[model samples]
Target chain A: MTLLHSRRQKEIRKRLEGMRPRLYRVAFAWTHNRSLAEDLTQDTLVKALQAARQLRELESLDAWLFRIMSNCRRDHFRNQVSTENVDNYDLVDERTPETRSSEQQLIQKVRDSVEALPETHRQTLTLVDIEGFSYMETASILEIPVGTVMSRLSRARARLRKLLATQHVDVRGNDSNARLRRIK
Target chain B: MTEMEHITEEMLNAFIDQELADNDMMHVYLAMSKDPDLRDRVCELRANKELLRAAYRQVPAPRKYQRPPGLLPRTAMAAGIMSLGVGALLGWYAHSFSQSDNPPRTVARAYQTFDSKVKVVFHVSRNDAAAFAQILDEAEALVAAEDDKRSNNSVRIVANGDGLFLLSAKASPFKDRIRILSEKYNNLVFAGCSQTQKRLQRERGLSVDLLPQVSTVNSGVFEVLRLQEAGWKYIPI
Candidate 1:
């Protein structure tokens, strides 16, 4: 309507752009497939832009975007969940046993362990641990009770610890060629 | 010091995650200090969370987003940001006026009035009553002078920070005068900055109630920039 209004709209557009990588990481965690994750991220952003006016508070932005992403991810799997290829999950370590740097292997193991978790628990864990969302915000994003979020997160962590046998994360990407760079 | 048997895994998780309330948080601290095993268990859960956080932060190389050109280009109701020279400013002014709810003749009449007057923006970011008095004096005089000639020229007062007092419903001393002047001048706008309002609430726990006649913008500084970019004379008070 006015340049001032356009500039304000552009501010929102810029914010959405800044959120892309974070959205992708969450999406990737959900789908365990890069392209699907990318598509989910892209769709979530486009939907967010279209529905930007509906968002009233900036403090709730992370929860709001993740909610949109959750919807998009749900919509994607709604019709395709059963028919989707199980082997398409390429989260396995890409390197040969000799060539595999332990860090890459650990990264793959983390992805696999997380994927093995129940969907609700995995969502709670990633939202809290990875995105640093507070328990309340995670509850809102996942549309569950705070008590439920805490329980799911607790179960997820316990299962992860058992899966990895209480392993601590110490491996940095010591080798450049064998490294998985930090994303989001 | 609390008993080792008292700490549940949920409370330990909440404590390690810093999700516990202040009182319970202290309770966990007391228990952990009293019991070595409790501390060790909290440390383990904390470490596991850190591990997940770290591992997920790493990933394979990403394919560039094939974002189509003009992913969010201008819509019918909105336009792109245009460089405003002397002519461009008037054009944009007229363009904006045209889009307003005013009738066709009013748009033309308002354009003429805008062209004749030097548009003004008064910026206030302080609670100094003296400065506010000066701003009110200058603003009232400017608009009243234009009223003598029967012109509805535009003026804006963009306030943020402590300057928001000028628009505060209960705090503003010149509430009656502002209401009177606003009623007299068709295009005089009083805008409060939302950023400052949010900051005040978050930091100082103040809930600001603006005067009924005033509107709000995302940022007061941004409003100043908007007016100046559109060729309005900026007078910071």
Candidate 2:
């Protein structure tokens, strides 16, 4: 029995191992803090392994792992919100170099826009667009209805467009070339 | 276009995502063909989705974590200390178990049965013996690890195109490993594409004999796609 139990754990580890990158990506996208993302991913993995026996089917593992991650992230925020002021997280450093290229600036601007979105919308966008999950898949991962996923995704994209416009990056994540356009 | 309601953002979003019903999808397509404004909106949405995907796809996966292979090994201790340690361990275990049972904050689906069976489909388009060997190694590792978790496991290596060469009895250098893997893992399978075989016959007038362990499939690409639709993770090698 001991040998058999150990064998089962090895298998669980392998399956979870393949998902590390994807889990980290989702975690990093959410937290925008590499260390926290790593921590979250690690914790999620541990919890998933402990609960592996409860998993009834292999097909649901992706969504199951993601759901655990989603909860882990939320719990982290709840603990963080009570002790720290998360409002100042957006304060930018004024000492940044001026030699940054327009491309870098546009990338930064897009990142900021995505990071500023409401948590639900950001997650929806990340899972659907970045992760290439279908609407139903995203819904399953987020534990929301398909309609909610659609609305959140739509709103997130619209918000990103508006936010990027303010930073002078066009909706497509490029520098605005409107000034170069010939006036018709 | 003139008779219908103006396209709402939701409708346009749905169209962009290809989530619309067939009639509605056609309606949007027809509208875009005639209305440049509608076309531009779709373009904007497409561009936005593209930009988002490009930005996030670059984030690398986490460094591979090295976890202990199993529970910590039992240690030797004095009898009194051992008794004390056992009690503490039991208490800690109970606490952790209860904590884990808390209603998960996110929406969770019913436990699925896939836990009992892991389905993997390897798409092999090359005949590299070295690469195929690596695949077998990975599969072996998976089977070993899964021994405790599921009662059954499935790993399929679908060879097509030039990849069929890896399974060819006449040319494969790793024939010994392939045979060994087949003998060891009853759940593992090697599949050769019949379509590729037919093409080879027609184009080169060559007939290939696959290892006896390999089964023939109608089409490699079709098999991969079908397996993906069936929820098997597709690993392209």
- Estimate the Cα RMSD of every predicted model relative to the unseen true structure: 17.5, 24.2
Q: Which stretch of 10 consecutive residues in model 1 chain A shows the poorest summed lDDT?
A: A169-178
lDDT of 1 by residue, A26-64 (tens): 877776777667667756865675466678876677799
- In candidate 1, how many Å is residue A22 off? 0.8
Candidate 1: docking tier: incorrect
Q: Estimate each model's TM-score.
A: 0.54, 0.52
Please list the residue runs of candidate 1 whose C-alpha ends up more than 4 Å from where it truly belongs after superposition: A2-5, A82-93, A166-184, B64-237
Candidate 2 reference-contact recovery: 0.37
**lDDT tens readout by residue for model 2, A1-184:** 2221355545655677568678988887887755567667766865675467677777778888998999878866754643454442435553265755554565566678899999999999888777777788889888899989888888888898898678786653345532212234
Error of 2 at B165 (Å): 63
Weakest ten-residue segment in model 2 chain A by summed lDDT: A175-184
